[model samples]
Target: MSLSRLVQRLRHAALCAAVGLMAAVPAAHAQSDADAGAFPAKPLRFIVPYPPGGPLDLMARALGEKVRASLGQPVIIENRAGAGGNIGADVAAKAAPDGYTLVMGAVATHAINPWLYASLPYDPIKDFAPITLVAAVPNVLVMNKEFAQANGIASVADLIAYGKRHPGRLNYGSGGNGSAGHLAGELLKARAGLDALHVPYQGAAPAQLALLSGQSDFMFDNLAAAAPLIRDGKVQALAVTTLARSSLLADVPTIDESGVPGFDLGTWFGVFATGGTPEPVVQKLNQAYVQALRQPDIVDRLRVMGSQAQPLSAQDFARMVAAEKEKYREIVKLSGASIN
Candidate 1:
């Protein structure tokens, strides 16, 4: 054979060997897909980026109890709270894309924290695959019952007027800097053109305590946690932070209806796995959580907690997360909030 033909034959043999080798071992990519196909074949670790007893932890525990039954594996709850949920979220983000690790991602984890921290440990959009939105609860603008009565504040309008009159004297407390409560207060301030001071506490419970102790005049707090206080007459609900009235609190009007037209804000909890998790795994998770939410006991318990179970498909949930992320970005800009 000529030299050129010999060189061509050698290249053909090399290409055949490469193809055989490629067919022989599909290492990194094939294993994960195989694992996902048999997803949750073993116990899964569920991370809640908050301490036990908080709403996120409670929701995870509630859903985990049911999902584990369907998954046929224990769903272990791990609390990794810190850095406004960034610590735990980063852990989830950096975790193996194997289908075993999941996180109960909250508004802070997937939406607000990215904007609040100048250098976030995780990328909300890039680091995780949204399984589904678990639930959304309204936030109620509330004040100490005695404080409202003493100040003669009867409604959203009254509160705004009082703030205007008192200017910086009206103080509001929040779970922490850039928390939903803080942003709600800032939103109200911008919409109503009131002058008020923002006080940040360690957590929602502490912020509510500040209100009860009269250290702060008011706060926008989760209806689930604040509803009992409102019902027991410890705190008075001024208006809910939603465009529409919360079904659990029908008697209370929405901020849009009360005085601030077009006002709407609320908190959401969702499930997410590391970004490259197999889509099949994500769909499986979405189905489990959706079915879990539909359980009568879960529905009843959520209602009692002042929230409703929202079961959306993975696609729909992704759209919701995207919109919320945009909304939070705007709010963070408007409020000029940053952890740095």
Candidate 2:
């Protein structure tokens, strides 16, 4: 037993530690590769941040069914409806970035909520990896048939003229204070320089009922929900709240074309994964959702529901979201819409 024997023992121990560390590095890399290849090895949680039976929920279920066939995994729809879709969006934002969790993000969640909410739980642009846009539904300017007839408001121009003449007399009803319908009404007021009272109901159905019962003068109603009422001569359709006319309401003009220049708004929703999801997985999700959107049945169903499915690539979708968010920032500020 000497100093030389002790030094040899130390050297042998150091070499063994180095060998073990090298082996562990390779094993870690192998595990990572395996995980990368197993994209969506289990069911995916598809969050629809609204209540069931709505367009977003129905479309999510349809897309989930279609994608399940191709991805070989079930897409579970999780409706987390509250705080104007912020709760569900926050859930998806904080979820693991393994591409298994996705949220059906909408204009409200990604664009409007960021600006409306006093403190948002997540950054819409930074916290999500865009998959693809699912659908866009146009809002229609509909008035009670009796109100329009009695007031001589046969078109958007007439309504604007009457509103300007009557000032605070013409009132509009919406789903809620900060809802898209309310915002649309506010935008209309701003654009046309008309003064109208905003009457907010607990939900769109209630707002539409107010309009139908003549409790409210008019409303910015979802075209899908108002289409039947309009067809039945219960409500009079004036114009759609989109730059482009809705195919379902072929004869109707857009607010942009109805004397309110530069006016455009719609309900648009899409899919988004956790921000740090791998690029390949994002692309795969885009393809799957876009494919589902392009299906003949899906296309027809959306058309019937007054929604248009125009899917875009993931990069393009991201750009669209960014642009829309900026657009809504100004709109929300102008509307003075806020949430605590």
What would the TM-scores of all predictions be?
A: 0.87, 0.89
Lowest lDDT block of 10, candidate 1: 1-10
TM-score of 1: 0.87
lDDT of 2: 0.87
Q: lDDT of candidate 1 vs native?
A: 0.83
Best by TM-score: 2
The lDDT for every candidate, in the order shown, is 0.83, 0.87
- Candidate 1, position 158, lDDT: 95
Candidate 1, residues 99-212: lDDT per residue as tens digits?
A: 689999988888888788989878898888888777777889998788899989989999989887886778899988788998998988899997888999988899999899
Per-model RMSD to reference: 13.6, 15.4
**Model 2 poorest 10 in a row by lDDT:** 1-10
Query: Tens digit of lDDT per residue, candidate 2, span 1-340?
Result: 2112222344466467768789586776566556568777899999988899888899899999999998899999999999999999999999999899999999999999998999999999999999988777889999989989988999889998998788779889999978999999999988898789999899999999899899999999989999999888899999998777888999999888889887878888889999999886887788788889999999998999887677777876787788788888888998887888
